[model samples]
Target: MSSPKILSVDDSRMIHTLINKGFAPYDVQMFFASNGAEGLEAAAKEKPDVILLDVTMPVMDGVECLGKLKADPALKDIPVIMLTAEAGKENVLKIAKMGVRDYIVKPFTEANVIDRVSRLVTLKPKSAAAAPAPAAAAPAAKKARIATDAIKILVVDEHPAIAESIAKAVSKRGWKVVPCAGPAEAQPHIASTVSSEETPDVILVSLAFPGKGALKFYQSVRMNPTLKGIPMVGLSVKTAIFDQNEAKETGYIAIFTKPLELGELPDRIARAMDLDITPIFYSSEGDCQVVSIPQDLSETGSIDLTRQSRKKVADFVNAGFSKLIIDLTGVTKFEIPLIRAVASIIHECNGLDIKWRIVGDDADNLPNLPTVISTNLKVAALKELPNPFTNTAPLDIYPTRAAAAAAF
Candidate 1:
């Protein structure tokens, strides 16, 4: 899951830096804006969970900015925190009526800002003050946590030391860790456990393992009902967009570089499992081919190929492309559209004349996609190919139109 993003809308670079640093302890992706207009734009693009607005700015004042943000239906749900030197009760009350989450007085302590932000981030909203007692107070009949349902985790790596390090770091967070020194060892463990009631919640795979080995691990882990929805995260010493692309196809949800700012690991892990704030990961896996759809699919190519991209995927039964290679070893959240598009295309291409296979996605992003996908596609590792094409084949999940055309 992407961190709970915060957009700091302040004319003062000092304040923006301060808020960001102070909240650094918490897992969050921070965005900065000098004033209201830029702040609004950032909010739309970043979809920040929280906004810190400065009252006085060169163009739009905080109050007016807050008004505009609340007016936009798309931005309204996001919590806004108005910051200013104004400590008057009247001023606070005024901003409060505008739906601001909380008002912070400038020249404030870092602790104050952190506390207020944390409170807002953790709270739920209500249409009216008198909304019925919260859901927690009225517990449901479902059993809360089954003993066998304890969080299941799989650690995949070629290096025993690294696998042990990750397992040690993550175990502190209360999740059960099952470490596999290589994908070969990981497969049977995952296969046997996946069909059980509670499957592993997370799989941390190292890309250094042989591509074929990694793919097999992901395939086994994802091909079962109990394990299908688990989120997989990749951990490696080297972090690159390419690495992320390679592992993304096999269904990993998030990717992180090793020597990992270890302190943040627990929080990131929690967020991935917590569906409310989870970020979407996009990958050109299966029948989902992430092309700059608006541009690559265009004739004249007037579209901004960089900003608005689309994925072209064949529906499950209709899919025919035979060479399947997915690179998800380095992927994070920006690739969600591609992931959804791939699933859609695969669904459309099912039962088609084409023989499809996949490579990469060693991290297990979409842990359960394989089980659902197996019904329609013949997924495999690039190394598993029987003939002709070899591992050297330049197949990227996020391929250029020319590259995809060449592959076809």
Candidate 2:
């Protein structure tokens, strides 16, 4: 198979040289552009598997260029990863909403760039060639190792041994696996899956494998909605300055190093889901550090507050996260058991070292009856007994649900 082509658009020749040097060991064809317009031109002609886009340029900045590339029918499917100087929350959210695969802040390490790109491309797979038709098989079906609708996990690395190890670790969790040698082969898979309704759930990628090729692929995946929500985790043996920053800037939920631990996956998967199920504990300095639960309680939707959740919440209160933030925003309708369970959590919090605060959007029923009924059991930190904390309270009515959540 031919090496995958990577289009790297940046004003800095140093970055281009660094990227090429980092990717030299991989099977990659490199393309460079000094500005977004030229980058677009190259992308249109080359139809490169992935494009590494720098956000700031002299003519037609990265954002504009990205819009043009995505809008064009012939080039839309190609993935583009944006390279920006500042990976601020606002900027990230803006580009994210605009559909960039991923963003790496400036001064990123070579490994960071490669790691992010590899995962995104592998998850989506794109190419010019048509897929081969499925062949006929025997009537007796084989019980598949992975379910057809299983959460797909993409593993990227040049080393077969490492890839196999990752596959073993992830398989323990009952996830489907797709392994690729580098970004070139990965892009076609990304494209095909992306064109369909079902996409991979998570991507585990190595930054050093395809280097810049990974960057381009990440860009493309971020732009597509089907692939956007999928979780990404980066793997590397050694962490560098840029590598750590890139992990944060590129929007990966977490980064892990090689000699992969099978046990750590449950926590990683939980974070990827953004469950807020992890408990926040106050450090000696009063800062917060997260403590993980054995399983994602949110995934199960309703957890019996019998022992485990009760203990976890109690621990948080003991550790000084007694200032509780319960998000009842999704819950308009509540059952009696759920209400009681919540009340139990609060009761446990109050007895511990911390003060519990019930912070959430306002309920539809003012002086909500369920809440009132459960008040004796409430143990959250707050000022008033009946009224939940509000910024500009004593309102004639209640603030909007969003407003209440923010205040609490």
Candidate 3:
């Protein structure tokens, strides 16, 4: 059998890149189109097994493209999943009337994307569907192989089966899983903790949890000073646009569609809690020195990341490296102190006549320093770097630090 073809229609090149990486492990052919018009053309020619259509686009939007697809005799039978930033009820009804197979909101995880795509397309072989092998090793060994510290997670789901499945997956990673049936049941767990370490590192609440009370629970948590920082992710059977919008508006770090991808739950938890599983590293690629930050810097233990960054920069400068690239793609939060520290470092780099650029999505969130250049794409950052001796302005400049400071 030939590889399944997956077509993605989006105006953002970053989304296209993410889709490619999310499905890289699977056995499938991926196609890309900038807008609905291009998507329609690609659909007719490729006849892709699955289409991931973005709702908002120039020239033609996803709804229009989906309408065209459903109307076409050859493409009408193909499955299409809607992707959008808006999850309003109105949008959901509009897409539902058009017959989309499923919908995924923005800021989704790689696992979320893969899980949804798998539901719509048969990318793997039947022989690869063997039952998972049982673990013969001790739980201690599993814990040692995974996390060094015990992670505590509070799971609130009305559905017993789904909650148990989620608990089982989290337990495999050596984390402690506390299962609660509803907001009332979960209250004790949240209130019992006296300190951050004692508290659940993260909470997974089902939107449909008994009484539709997950939002109430989220509000309560946010109102409490101690629990406010503890990230919460929503799980829901409702893939409708309105439900998604509600989940996001309720301030969930992410809202995943059920059934959850058991294997990917722990990683999602780590991301939601901003836990850094690995240490940041520095490497050299040709003429550029690349410093890759950890996926979650907020969990970097007792070490002062900002100070460490300063020392690293001093060392790099002393070692005669003129061009540096700091990769912050894995970092989720950009605190003001971090911004100030980075700005100071960039100022130092400027004094040393060193050229530098930062690659990450939160660059926009960073306080713009005149000395620093940032780009959402790594290649774009690298391409735009100017020679230090030329005294020319850096390319692809972001908003200035003054503007960011004022906004803050």
Task: Give the number of the best model, judged by lDDT.
Answer: 3
Q: Could you estimate the TM-score for every candidate?
A: 0.32, 0.33, 0.37
Q: Worst 10-residue stretch by lDDT in candidate 3?
A: 399-408
What RMSD, rounded to one decimal, does every model reach?
21.8, 24.3, 23.0
Evaluate residue 216 in candidate 2 and report its C-alpha lDDT on the 0 to 100 scale: 61
Q: Tens-digit lDDT track for model 3 on 1-408?
A: 788999999986556766776777678899999999999999999999999999999999998999999999999988999998988999888898898999999857667888998887776743445667667743444222224357887888877787778778767557887888889888876773556566787788888754548878998777768787778988887555566677789798887778776655666676566654333345675566665554433322213343445555555554545666655564556443333334444554665545766665554543343333333112332343332222324434224322222322
Sorted on lDDT, best first, the list reads 3, 2, 1
User: By the TM-score metric, which is better: model 1 or model 3?
Assistant: 3
Please give the CA lDDT of all the candidate structures: 0.57, 0.59, 0.68
Q: How accurate is candidate 2 locally (lDDT)?
A: 0.59
Q: Please say which candidate is ahead in TM-score: 2 or 3.
A: 3
Cα displacement (angstroms), candidate 2, residue 351, comes to 7.1
Model 1, residue 293: distance off in Å is 45
User: Model 1, residue 12: what's the lDDT?
Assistant: 65
Which stretches of candidate 2 lie above 4 Å from their native place? 1-149, 192-197, 275-408
**lDDT comparison, 2 vs 3, better candidate:** 3
Per-residue lDDT tens digits for candidate 1, residues 1-408, read 555788999886456556765776666777999988898889889989889899999887778888988899999999988887989988888888899988888777667887888886752222355567676766466443321235677778776776666667657445677777877777676675445544466778876665555556667777765567767787755745566677777677777787765545654565556422111222344454432221011211111111221222222112323333233333333232333333433332232223333333333433333433332333432122122222233323323333443464
